[model samples]
Every structure is written in C-alpha cells, then in structure tokens.
Target: MDAAPIIVHRPRGTGGRRVTVRGQIIGLAHSDRDLIEFLRQSGLDETTAEEMVGSNSAMIEWRGGRPHDYAAA
Candidate 1:
C-alpha cells in the first residue's frame, strides 16, 4: 500500500512555517531563494535543486530520522 501524502501550509507573514512529516522537518523553505539554499544544504545536486524550485510543492521520504529523499509533488 502507498503512504499518505504530506501537506504543509505556511500562512503568509509568519516568517515561514515548519513542515514536519512523520515527525521530521522535510520542508523548510519559504521562498524561491530559500528553497534553493535549503535544497543545496540538503545535499541535493544542482539540477535537482533547480527542478525543485520550479515545483509548487514536494514529497519527501524520510530515513533514519532525517530527510533521506524527496521528489517534486
């Protein structure tokens, strides 16, 4: 069976929101630049980081209590 989708809603003007999936923070970016930095900090390749910036949302997979993997959702 497939797992349920993770949804993160960050309200405007709140300095961004913390996105936690399965008790882990998978989404930490609030803007395009922030996303780029986040992705780069997460060890994602340049291509993947660029691709992620174009996406409206993302799906992340956790492993060992950390962001082990992710894909544009």
Candidate 2:
C-alpha cells in the first residue's frame, strides 16, 4: 500500500499537535490517544497505531517537540 508519511507538527497555542500527511493536515491531537486514533483511522490496527505513536517510527516525523509532548513551548 502507498501512503504519505505522517508529520506531527509543533504544538499550537491550544496545546494541540497538528497531524499531517504529504503536507495535508489530517487532524489535531491533544494527547497520544488522539494520535493513535488518527493512525487507526488511517488504516493501522490497534497494536500498530500504539507502536507508531509510542516509538520513533520512521513513518512519522515528529517536529518541534519530542514524542508525548503536547504542550506548546
């Protein structure tokens, strides 16, 4: 299957992280759970979604902040 890479951008003023793929915004996540749900909705299963959000998976590019960090700095 072909899919655009995921990018989790820096947290915004509302402490929500913008999730995108191929420069298209997909959704905003306030926590890891929200991120996982987005991944799941994008075709990943539960375990895979959790792993992708927890680990530094190459499929996802985390920008401006580390994983699990949702508070704007």
Candidate 3:
C-alpha cells in the first residue's frame, strides 16, 4: 500500500468514516462529496479536492472499506 498522507478510516458502527490528513482528523465522510468538502476545508480547492477523491488518488489511503463504502458495520 502507498504511504498516503490522507486516510479514510474504517466505517463506524453508526455511520461514516473518519477522515484524516497528515494524522489530523478532518471530519467524518459518508460520501465522496463529503470527503471533497472536508479536503476543501483543509485548504484544497474544490476542483482539486473533487479530482483527488474522484480519481482515487494515491495520496489517500482507504482502510477497512473501499472508496464510497460508508455503511455502518
């Protein structure tokens, strides 16, 4: 796996996945759009954030679930 800086952690029991950038929690994301917004809030432009999440960029590490998988477990 790539040593990515952005991490979308496992889905929680209630819902959503915790998102972290450089080890700092950004927010919980239930969808790609939410993830993009969190990235934007972290100083990334909307277009860039969208692209990053959409393309499944190597900068992000998806754990315990595939991208877009946010159902409670």
Give the top-scoring candidate (TM-score): 3
Q: Write the per-residue lDDT of candidate 1 for residues 1-73, one digit (tens) a residue.
A: 5542333334324444444444556665455555555556667787786675565335532322223223222
TM-score of each: 0.45, 0.84, 0.93
RMSD to native for every prediction? 9.3, 3.2, 1.4
- Model 3 agreement with the true structure over 2-60: per-residue lDDT tens digits: 47999999999999999999999999998888999999999999999999998989998
**Ten contiguous residues minimizing lDDT sum, candidate 1:** 63-72
Q: Model 2, 1-73: lDDT tens per residue?
A: 6543999999898788999877777799999999899888887898998997777788888888977898866
Candidate 1 overall lDDT versus native:
0.47
At residue 36, candidate 2 shows an lDDT of 90
For model 1, the superposed segments whose C-alpha errors exceed 4 Å read 1-8, 20-23, 26-28, 57-73
- Output the lDDT of residue 48, model 3: 94
Candidate 2 CA-lDDT value? 0.85
